[model samples]
Target: MQQLLDHVAALKGEFDREVFTDSYWAIRDEYDLGAADEQFWPPVFQRAGIESDPTLVASAAAKDAELASTIAREPHQLLLEIADAGVPLGILSNAPHRMAQSVRESDWASVFAHLVFSSEHGLMKPDRAIYDLAASHFSDVEPSTIHFFDDRERNIVGAHAAGWHGHLWRSVDQARFELRSLGILTKR
Candidate 1:
C-alpha cells in the first residue's frame, strides 16, 4: 500500500509537496474499491485542479513492478499441501491486475480452480459484491465447504459476515493446523 502511495506521489510531478499530499490522500480517503488505479489517478489530479501528465497514468506494470522487486515470495506450502490432498482451491484478492496475472502465470496456477482479483472485477474484498462474485465462481459447491485465508483481520471480518470460512493467516503451519481441525488437511 505504501508502494502505491509512493507511485502516486512520484506521478504528482513537480507539484507543491503539501498540495500533492493533500490531493493524493483526498482521493484515497474516498477511493472507490470498485474502480481501478487507472481510473483513480486522473480524478485525483483533476480534483487538485491540475492537469495530469500525459505520460503519468497508472498502469498494471507500474503497480506491479515495485512489489515484485522488493517483496520476497516464500513457498506457499499450505496451498501445495491442500492441492496434494485433492482440495479444490481458489484465490480471492484485492489488488491490481498485474499481481493477479502474475499468479496465473505461476507454475502453481493449476493448484487453484479460480483466481479473482478486484482489479478485474472492479470490487474489492470486504465488499459483499466481490465476495458474492467469488462465490459465484464455485456455484456447484456449498458455502459451508469453502475456506478463505487472509492476513488482514478486516477482510476476515468481511468474509465471516459473508458466510465464508475465514481464517486469519499467520504461517503455513498454523494454517495447516486450522485446516486439520476442519478436516481440510490430513497428510500435511
Candidate 2:
C-alpha cells in the first residue's frame, strides 16, 4: 500500500510539474483564451506541448472528446456486494456536481446511500470541511465506523484526520480486502 501511494504521489507530482507549463498559457491565449472555459484547459494543456497554438488546442480538444467517450465503465460488483451486506455506503468525491449527477443517472448511484460532491458544497476533498460534511451524513455511525475510499492519498489522509477509516483505492479487489480487514465488509 505504501508503494502504491508513493507511485500515485509521484504521478501527481509529474503531472503538476509538466502539464501546466508556460507554453500551455501561450496556447490558451491563442485560443482567444478567455473565450474557452475551464473545461477546455486540461486537454489543451496536455495536447499542445506548450507551443500555445490554435491548431494544437483544437486537435487536443478533439482527441480528448474521443478519449472521454471511449472510457470503459468498470463493473460495480464490489460496491454492490458491500451494500448488499447492509453496510451504509457513502461517496465523498471532489468531482463537479454535474459529474455527480451523471453518476447518479448511471447505475452506480444505486449502490450508495449518500453521495456528497465537492462542487455542491463549495469545498473539495482534503479540506476538512468537505470531510466534515460527509461525516455528518453518517451521524448514527461513529466517525471510526465510517470508512472512506478515494484514489487520492491526500483525501485518504484527510479522512484519517477526520476520524474515519481510510482506504487508498486502487482496484476493487484491494478495496474489498481493505474493507474486510477493517470489519466494514463481510466475506461472501
Candidate 3:
C-alpha cells in the first residue's frame, strides 16, 4: 500500500484551503474538543470560523467532496474484489461521515461490512480506541484473521499494535499481491 500512502501524502500537500479547512473542523470534533488542549482550536477554528456545535463544523466538510472525488484511485476496485471473495471488509477512516457517504454513493459501499468513521465514533485512527472498535466487530474471528488496509502508515502501525494484520496500502497491484501471499486470494 505504499503507492496509496504516497498518493495520499502527496494530496495532503496539494490540499486546497477549503479542503484543509473542512478537515480541520472535522478532526476537531472527532477528538472531542473538551478533552483537547485549548491551543489546538483557535487558529484552525478561526480560519474556518467554526462554532461550538460540531454539526456546523461537520458541515464545513461539504467542500471536500469535490476534491476527494477528483483524487479517486484504483485500490477501491481491489477492495471490492476482496469483498466479492466473501472476506468481510471494514472501513476505518479518519474522514468525516460525509466522506463515507460519498463512498457509499460512489457504488462502493456494498463491499464494506462495516464503516467505522472517526466522526461517528468520536475517535480518530492512530488512537487505539477506534482500532479496538473495529476489532470488536469481528469477535468471532481472531484479530490476526482480520486484515486491515489503510493508506496511512500511522494507521497501519496502530492496527498492528492492536493485533490486527494491516496492509499499508500503496497500489492496487501491491495490495492484491499481499492478499494473495496471505492466502486471502488464490492464484489463477
Candidate 4:
C-alpha cells in the first residue's frame, strides 16, 4: 500500500509519508461514507502540499479500486456450498465507494443476495445503524434467526447487539462448525 501511496505522491512532486498518512486518516471516515473520488482526493493532495490535479485524482481512484479488488481472495468453498444450498448470503462491508464498485464488478458479486457498503449508506460496521440496515436486507427473516461471521470482534459484538447470532471468524473450519451447530449448514 505504501508503494501505491508513493506512486500517488510522485504524480505531483515529492511525497511526504507523514503528511499523506495524516491527511488520509483525517478524512478516512468521510471516504468510507461514500465520498466520491473527486470529493475526497483533493483534500489529501492539498494537505500533502500538492496541487489537486484532476489527473492525479483519477489515478489515485484507479489505484484504490485496483487494490480493493485484490484485497479479498476467492470466496471460501463453504460459502459457495451454503449459497448452493439455497441459503441467502449478504455482504456488509465498511469500505470506500471505489472498493464497493470493485466488489460489485467482481464475479463473486452474483453469489450474494445483497451487498451493503458503508460508502452507500453512510454507516459502518460496529455501528448499530449499519447492523439494523443489514438486518433489513433479510426482509422476512427475524434478526434472531440471522447469523453473521466477522473477523473483527467489534463487528461481531455489533451483530449480537442487533439481536443476530454472531460468530468471531477464525477459519473456514470454525465457521463451518458454527454454522452446523446452529443448524444453518448440516452437510458433512
Candidate 5:
C-alpha cells in the first residue's frame, strides 16, 4: 500500500504521503475501497487531483502490484499445520474484492472457511458491523474465541473492541507460539 501510494504521489504533486494516506482511509471508511474492486480508486485519485483512470495509474505501477500479491510460504505452511489439527480458520481483510479472487486462485480458499472483506459489505475494519458480519459466518463460535491477526494497531484495537481476540501480527513463529498457547494447534 505504501509503495502504491508513493507511486501515485510521484505523479501527482499535491497528494503527498500524508494527504494520500488521509484520503485513502477516509474514502475507505466512507465507501469501502473494495466496493467496486479497483474502481473505488478513481474517485480517490480524483480527490488527489489526478483524473486519469485509477486502473491505468495502477497499471503503470505493475512492479508494486506484483510485489503486493506475493504470499510467503511460511504462512501457507502455518495455515496447513493448524487446519490439519482441526482448528477452523477465517480471514477478515480490509482489502478489495480482488483479494478474494486471489485467495480463490490460491490454496488459501480451502484453508479458510470464509474470507470476509470490506468491499463486499460496504464497510471496513474498525467498523463493528464488519466484525459482526464475519462472526455470522461462524454461527456457533463466540466472537471472544475468534482470534484476528492484523499488522495495524488500530485494527487490532478495533477487533478487540468488537469482542474478538485480535492480536498484532509479527511473525509466523509468533503466531504458532500464540496458537499453541491457545491449544488450537495441538497435534492430533
Candidate 6:
C-alpha cells in the first residue's frame, strides 16, 4: 500500500497522508453508499496532490479492496460452525463496492445466507434503516433473536435500537462466548 502511495507521490511531486485521509473521510459515506471506486479515488488523490491517473487510481482501489479478503479470515471457521449448526448467518458491513465484491468472492462467503453491503443498500452502519434492512432478511426470527456483532459502539447501539441483540466484538473468543451465552452457538 505504501508502495502505491509512494509511486503516486513520485508522480505528483507531493502527497500528504493527512490530506488523503481527510479527503477519504469526507466521501466515505457516499462511497459506501454505492459510489464507484473510480469515483472515490480521484478526489482522494487530488486532495493529496497525487495525480489522479486512472491506472494509478485503479491500482490503489484494488489494493484497498484486498483488505476485506484478508481481514475476514479469523471469523471464517466460527461462521462455518454456526452455519453447520443450522443457524442463518448474514454479514452487514459498511464498505465500498470493491471491498464488498471482494468479500462476496471470498472462501467464507458460502457460510453466510446473506451478504448485506451498505454499498449496495445505500445505508451504512449506525443508521436505523440499515439495521432494519439486515433484520428484514431474517423475517422468520424475532428481532431479539437476531444477534449482531460490530467493532463500533455506534453500530452496536443501532443494532440494539433495532431490537436485536448486539455484542461488541473484541476478539473471536469473545464473540464465541457471547454467541454461546445468547444460545446462538452451543459450547464446543
Q: Any idea what lDDT model 5 has?
A: 0.72
Poorest stretch of ten by lDDT in candidate 2: 28-37
Model 1 CA lDDT for position 12: 56
Candidate 1's TM-score: 0.68
Candidate of highest TM-score: 6
Pairs clashing in candidate 6? none
In model 1, which runs have C-alpha deviations exceeding 4 angstroms?
1-60, 63-75
- Quote model 2's TM-score: 0.64
Q: Residue 92: error of model 2 in Å?
A: 0.6
Order candidates by lDDT, high to low.
4, 6, 5, 1, 3, 2
lDDT of 6 by residue, 1-188 (tens): 55555656665666697788788789888889999878888988888777677888777777777755665656777887788889999899999989999989987787888889999988899999998888888889788888888999998999999998888989998988888887878987
CA deviation > 4 Å runs, candidate 5: 1-69
Model 2 lDDT vs. the true structure? Answer: 0.62
Error of 3 at 47 (Å): 4.8
Return the TM-score for candidate 3, rounded to 2 decimals: 0.67
TM-scores of all predicted structures? 0.68, 0.64, 0.67, 0.79, 0.74, 0.87
| lDDT tens digits by residue: candidate 3, 1-188 | 23322333343333345643564555555443122323333345455343334543333343444344333457666766787788888777775555655765666666777777776767888898888998788778788777888888988889888888878878778988999998897765
Tens-place lDDT digits, model 4, residues 1-188: 68668787567667677887799879978888888888988998888787877898889888877776663443357778789778899989888988898989987677889999999999998899998998898998898888888888999999999998888889888888778877878866
Q: Which digits, one per residue and each the tens of the lDDT, describe model 5 over residues 75-121?
A: 88898998899778887877665555555566555888888877678
Candidate 1: tens digits of C-alpha lDDT, residues 1-188:
45654665565544444565576556642333444555656766676555765466544245643464232334356667888898888888875555566667766667789888777877887887888889889989877677899998988988887888889989877887898988878852
Global Cα lDDT for candidate 1: 0.69
